[model samples]
Target: MDSEPPAAGIDVSKPHPARRYDYWLGGKNNFPADRASADVVAEAFPTIRLAALENRSFLRRAVDYLAEAGVRQFLDIGTGLPTAGNVHEIAQSIAPESRVVYVDNDPIVLLHARELLDSSPEGATAYLDADVRDPADILRKLDESRMLDLDRPVALMLVAIMHFITDDASPYELVRTLCDALPSGSYLVMSHATSDHMSAEELADTNAANQRSGVPFRLRTTEEFARFFTGLDLVSPGVGSVMAWRPGEWRPHPRPEAVAMLGAVARIP
Candidate 1:
């Protein structure tokens, strides 16, 4: 983690989803406000840290699967604070020529963008300090990166980020805009916080905690989450719990209800 002070535009007093997620992942780059929000949510959903870890594991396997599938270009949106086993690392490990463009709006993530910039000599990496709501701007920045080719089969990764976008924001449309720009063979890999696995009491407590947390969050149902993959060719085991999405056979699988997070990968036809 960078030892520097917070970026000028960052509001440390207000909790951001990225920082709250980092706290859950046991990363040190978080503020007191983030920890407070995370703890409040944890009180309702005791396995949130486990869910975070599971989601991250899902990301690693997704990237590995894509890389092995010959998808060398990646557009990772809502990229949180860079940690071990990032998109580029996993992809490039399988194919050194992989190219990645990571997008995130967090000021702290911008400050630490250098970690994402380190790329294999045969590949390239670029970080964009942009919001997911602005799909045009994100595509423009990807063009500027000069690494990812829209005509190629790019993997659009939205891991554990869409819950921050409220329903009125048209989250599905945002996804469509990005996918529409990609070629036929492109893929969309996403995991979102879901209420489908929660007990009634737990759901109530989680909703209350999120309302009080100051950061807007929407826990979608499996049906709602599945809407994001509409008209796309869903990879096998489509729209299931993140904990079991193509998890290798080496270890026993955890029950999906334990994480309460949904994940899926779909190819744009």
Candidate 2:
């Protein structure tokens, strides 16, 4: 853990999803506005906190699996505010030579990433202030910066962020472009929010509240979310709830409430 440094572009007025997510995960790097909005969302959908925790756990498992499968590079986009067991930490723990490039549109997340997302001596980490909708810009910046070798296998992580991109944003095309750019052995790890686990009234309430909060969360169906990985080969267990995807020894078991997000890992072959 790093020191409690000041955050950059920490807007206290408008509510940002990354900051609100940080607040939900029990981190202190969020503004009052973020906390208020997160509280409202959580109140509407009480299992939101569980969803965040499960999503984080899924990230750890996915990175570990990728690193063990010889993936030494990682590109984590829409990375929310830093918390325990981040991408670099998980990858480097399995293989110290892992390299990670984190991208996020949130300036506050970029600031925290620079301060807290430290890398091992044998590895490297960099932050890009960019949006997920601009895959070309991300690839260009990555090339110009020479942070990670594109020819090598890299894990593309888009955990719990796609719901923020509505159909109008062309999220599928963005994901396809990035996946197409990667080599055969590269991986795509994703966890997306869905209404599959919630009742009609619950889903309606969640949608209405999100509209009011300005987060624009678009919950997808299991099949709809799977479409993002069009040509990729899904890993073992295929597309399923985050809690059920390769969950090792974690006690108490995963209930439907905590596993609201669908998780999947696919290879570009």
By TM-score, the best candidate is 1
lDDT of 2 by residue, 44-118 (tens): 888788888888999999999899889999999988888889889988999999999999988778666765458
Q: Write the per-residue lDDT of candidate 1 for residues 1-269, one digit (tens) a residue.
A: 53335768788989988888988888888988888999988888888898999999999999999999999999999999989999999999999999999899998998889999999999999998799999999988878767787777999999998999998999999999999999999999999999997788978888999998888899999999999999999999999998778888778766777788999999999
Which pairs in model 1 have colliding backbones? none
- Give me candidate 2's TM-score against the actual structure: 0.94
Model 2 worst lDDT window (10 residues):
1-10
Off by over 4 Å in 2: 1-9
Best model number under lDDT = 1
Runs of candidate 1 exceeding 4 Å displacement? 1-4
**What TM-score against the true fold does each predicted structure earn?**
0.96, 0.94
